[model samples]
Target: MKKILSLFLGVSLLCSSCNDVLDVEDISNYNPELVWNDANLANAYMANLYPMFGNWNTGADAFSQQLAGINFYADRITITNGEFKLWNYGRIRLINQAIVDVNKGRLPDAVKANITAQALFMRAYTYFEMVRYHGGVPYITVPQDRYEDDLAVPRNSTAECFDLIIKDVDQAIAGLPKKIATTSADFGKIDANFALAFKAKVLLWKASPQFNPSRPFNNAYWAQAYEANKKAYDDLKAQGYGLVDDYSNVALVERGKESVFTVINSYPNKVANWDNGVRPGSESRGPASAVPTWEFIKEYPMKDGKMFNDPSGKYYKSEEALLQSFWKDRDPRFAKSIVWNGKVYEVSGKAGKRQYTALGVAHELDDFGVNPKAGVNSTNLDRYTGFFILKNSLLKLAQAEVQQYDVDFVVMRFAEVMLNYAEAANETGKMAEALDILKQIRKRAGIEPGADGNYGITANTTAAMRETILAERNVELAFEGHRFWDLRRLRMLDRLDGTTKHGVEAIAVQANGQDMPIGEAREKANRYELVESDFRYSLLQVPRSGVKVNVVPGKYYFFPIQRDILDRNKNLEQNKDWGGSFDPTLP
Candidate 1:
């Protein structure tokens, strides 16, 4: 089967296992031999292929860092030198190689289609991440030959890259199976809703303030974003995808219906860990990345669905009293996302108490023994901060020796689709539609769905709905890796700076066997204090190693291209005015 397919495709096909560079003895001599001869070989190869996505060394482990509070610059621990370029180039090579083999018709039609969809989806995904990080990158779709002139490809325009992503997603949606059959082992193929949701995502980013080239907010882009999001929400809802009845259980249950698409991380099938983004209770929680900021924790509106500063609400008080009252009425997601000190969360041992601390002076978990811990100059207090994220941490796994459990990595969810719809509608002046969607999500969360979803707010004006929807998204999707991009896409990065913010508050627990004093002890006991003046820098400067920075005032739009590539491809020009400069200046 593999042989015939190879002959037909006119090239060899090797799956993840066979193509692994780690196992290759002679890298230059690598070639597909048995890959075409066996069905199991093809299956194994395909299955192993996605490891790169999760390979901390390769793909961003997209979910972990994005969901956690880690920033890209200064908080640059997530990205490394040559890291971004390598993964993009490597994955493109894999997809290009597979496309060459599959086009030969040696494989079964189903196999060909499945592989094509996967390749297309991956290529699109690779480009999506690339654009998000680098603004735009060389759109390399095929494997370059030794003498190929495309090796020194210039960076494509961001608009062009977005167009390519839309095209690829469209093709994948058209060619892929509407649904993968239960008997089919070839799971994870791109589906209708997944592709649609992604299309909406791309459109939303494009329509957002940061990338919305149609400045002053283009009506067409807004409408397009709204239409795409609406279709995705409607389609998914029709397919039985809805919010989890009880919002608290959304992440607690693995792969819930609310999750439209997720990077399936099941135990036994794939023995992987996501602790590097988690906290101390788990083996990988060193460096303490993603520590929830006191500001973020305070964003959840009171459970009564009122702002913390509402003059009429019980939450209005001194910062201390305000937080105490605030914590009581906020959405349930707050507790699920943050691990306050003394709040019993799942830990390694049955009776073991997971003590969250700051500086690790009294807490061992805070000391990861690495440079700067989470990042250079990151507050040493961050090392022993008061809270840890519990949203995706597996409670049951706390008891097992390995603590193996399935933590679904949701790529697209019904709730997000709804939120996207609400955002687009509100942006496009469709206030009624926007209000309906926001209310639906709030209803599921067991909130009154009125503060933002009320008739007065919804019926007043489009701008009114806009703020409500954006705030609703923040509270609902807090810490799910959506904030950074959401802020950027919304073009509200700078705007978010002035908003009330919070971070993990640290208090001395113990030092050399001396218990913390009463004032500090009680302060630590509450675990709901707000951090003062939370916003530092909201945007990052494009590093000079890649391309000269030519960003415009009022926006941080510059992205670096490979300097060497520019040397080779003189035709390529850097972003306007940013080709040669060094200053993390505001856009």
Candidate 2:
């Protein structure tokens, strides 16, 4: 800002001989009125607004889906930690100011329409995030003057909030461009089809048990979700958007095909931090966060679409027996998403090296009482959940280049919309359509379709199919930030109560009480793996500050507004769950 001011003053000094000083305008300052007067300036203003949406790491791994996390899952989330607070009226004010200025601007009709649509979409997205956390917030459409305007505004009803969100999204759909191709310059920007998909997700939340707990199985709500999701699916399907064949490439490489909405990223610019955060420290030279829990590891079905506990499945056995060959013959996605004992993994600049996680290995150690200087989980004891995440790791990058990973953060994808449609359709008595969608998803995941081509899915009733859809979502959207919010919106956090999440510690033991030549794991893969005689396994109960499992409260569905926020606005009523009269569940 100082540089811009100096340049402006310099230009004024140069033009003093030709013009009057009183007529020169200070353009570098905050000028909302001047922004909408030109098309390119309006675009630059829109660019400034995109950073508020954040990245793909918010809900990626948490207690609702994975075993634990550093913040949201390490312990119970109380009302005051600000974990549940997303008070975004500041963002709403900016967006509303843009909307008002764009409508009043004298720019080209096309430019005005495009900018207005983008602003409306962002506003709707912000409101949806707030509603999901704290139900209805004050629906402020126009910017409130700091000193002149009356600032005491009450919260809107949940129904009124939804109506306003729908209106904004409808305008966005009407004015935004169609789906832009990967080759287009505007590929990552939100398009008409992506707006439609966002609307579908918003309606899905509206129909969920979080909002409709009293009328838990309302067909009207489900119908709304079904219709919107179907429209999005159809519109995007016609625009050449669908699932990419390889699961790893969907979020990493195929930007325009599977990704319905993407937060644009590139190297040396705004780069994605997902790979650096999840990959092992030994491999990526970053923290080994987001390691999978034992329970989460069991969540993946076998290659035949059967749980490992299914008696009829090929590898079904006792717990110890199952852990013996845990890394073998599972779903193709298992190897893609997780790195276990003695498994070959892709690392840049290395020639086919298998990862060893058992104790006594040179690097990988989550074992008790042993320390190594450069192992994967050696330094951070909390990160050693006995398994490391391998979902979106770059297949070819040297350790030094890990910081340069530039995969776009996929906020919404076609596969998620398909899941939304399936859930809504099944709830609204369109069972056949729902099952078909699920089958298509499983097919893309490389699950074996049985002789009848049903993909080993035997959920013949609505209740059963609903469970199946939820389970599929657990794996399909694993590290993409959908798990906790999914369970919250569905009112299924009770699933975590009374449940214990365990970890595994793999120790390298000497067979027959003598050292064996278990050299490289890949060469000795058949004999010296986790299930062999050279290793000992232990079930670990990892706790943070002596707290074992998650004990989420029921009122957590609608969190309380912070005391500071309530103190500022005298008209604001607090949520009843947090000791006030505003019941977030009331429709």
Candidate 3:
């Protein structure tokens, strides 16, 4: 492969002819001097830069999907192919070059600031993605050049990796324009709100069960975790970011109010559009690239702010009753996050008229194949039966499908910051205060708080508090792709691994000549149909075919440079696990 280093490696290499209009001929080849001199070239480059974070083939979108439990397999397991290896190195190359270019001083101050902040945010995000999957990675800051001597660095300690992440994000926050106050071309630059929200994410993950100092139960880490989350909550609030007053609109109409930051998508620039990425029904998110698990659906609590398993409640009657109770008067997010049999989604119907129907855009055969089976999980191969996702998804009621939804795939949202604050407060012994914050989020969602003020949580102890926080995290961020990571980080992957039955009684009733509610029947049909045994192995390990396995517990925390990466640099050392590791207690 040709080694291309355009932006950050050197400023003098950019061609001077590039201008602000999106009209550069021979755009494939990079001549930074020209591109950097023209504000439009700089803007175009920046525009392309942010969406890079949203692509499923790259960035956090890919990582978050894996972490969130929406795996390609039935449960949490991940399958491997050569494309996986290529994906890792390719991302590193693309991001490094973008960062280098933005740092060069040829663009306007505002343009330069926005691009630099975005690049930093992306870089930090990329690092987090790596650590969560492969553990500590070699901290590569500069682009690789023939003359560079530092190509073979070993894995940085997770803590060291986090420190570097903090620095990049801090710089991003300092340089990025304030999102709430900014407008026009600079409308969505990375800012204090985004930076702080991201920091909370990193810190919260680190403070989680899997990454905290303790392997499974690290109570001590709670204080530090809480502090990290609290910082984000306090800072974003000071900056005017908050929950959308109406709960339902938060996921549908007023996404910006709660999102700390996102890759903003628009029409015509459909290349930058997530339209194809998350489309539901027969054509979109339902077709199988990403599928929702029955267990994941079961994780949602009942309307009275209690788990369906609560022994004292009516929700515990049976799987069918439990599922029905879970969605009953609980929260508005249920409608926004889930697609049931009869739920109406906006789509273009056959008559050229827009219509709302439980089935979206009627199922039809296309390139992929048939629609998803009623109980069968969708994959890249299968299409949606009729249901589709509406949250953060753009749809139309016409054949000329134009995407008008502006809700950015908020990489970070203020609502998340608030949850972080509540979780942290609970850990730090500010239980009442934590409960208050939790209540505010619930109130915004039109649900009353739990008796403990944290979603009907009765446990005041730290352990119970943590569990409540995790549950709350799932509901607030469901379908946005937070559950998988939150579970893994909390070391609750095993709990989420097994199959769960939902709406059993409803299924019986449907069979016994009774017309059951759509939600109940859908739950029964979809829930009992799943066989979940693979979630435990979902977090992928680097393939043994590509490199020797050296990842031991402490040493095995990151991906080793591919042997190809090593062939080029004799100075680099591999991560501990790739070459030799025989710890008997692998989780």
Per-model TM-score versus the true fold: 0.75, 0.89, 0.70
Candidate 2 whole-model C-alpha lDDT, 0 to 1: 0.73
Give lDDT tens digits, candidate 2, residues 305-398.
8888888776576667767667656777888888765566657656656565654453543332132322334444454666778888875877
Best by TM-score: 2
Runs of candidate 3 with Cα error greater than 4 angstroms are 1-32, 55-118, 147-150, 180-182, 213-225, 271-291, 314-316, 323-330, 343-390, 393-396, 399-407, 449-455, 496-587
lDDT of 1 by residue, 247-348 (tens): 666655755678666556555554345444555533443444555545555566665555666665544554565543334555666666666644555456
Cα distance off (Å), candidate 2, residue 2: 25
Could you tell me the lDDT of residue 218 within candidate 3? 44
Candidate 3 whole-model C-alpha lDDT, 0 to 1:
0.51
- All-Cα superposition RMSD per candidate: 8.2, 5.7, 9.3
Q: Report how far off residue 188 is in candidate 1 (Å).
A: 3.2
Residue 311 lDDT, candidate 2, scale 0-100? 89
Rank the models by TM-score, top first. 2, 1, 3
Worst 10 residues of 2 by lDDT: 18-27
Residues 514-536, model 3: lDDT tens digits: 53454453453333321111001
Candidate 2 wrongly placed segments (more than 4 Å): 1-29, 70-79, 364-379, 509-536
Clashing pairs in 2: none
lDDT of 2 at 557: 88
Candidate 3 residue 19 C-alpha distance from true site, Å = 17
Model 1 has an lDDT value of 0.55
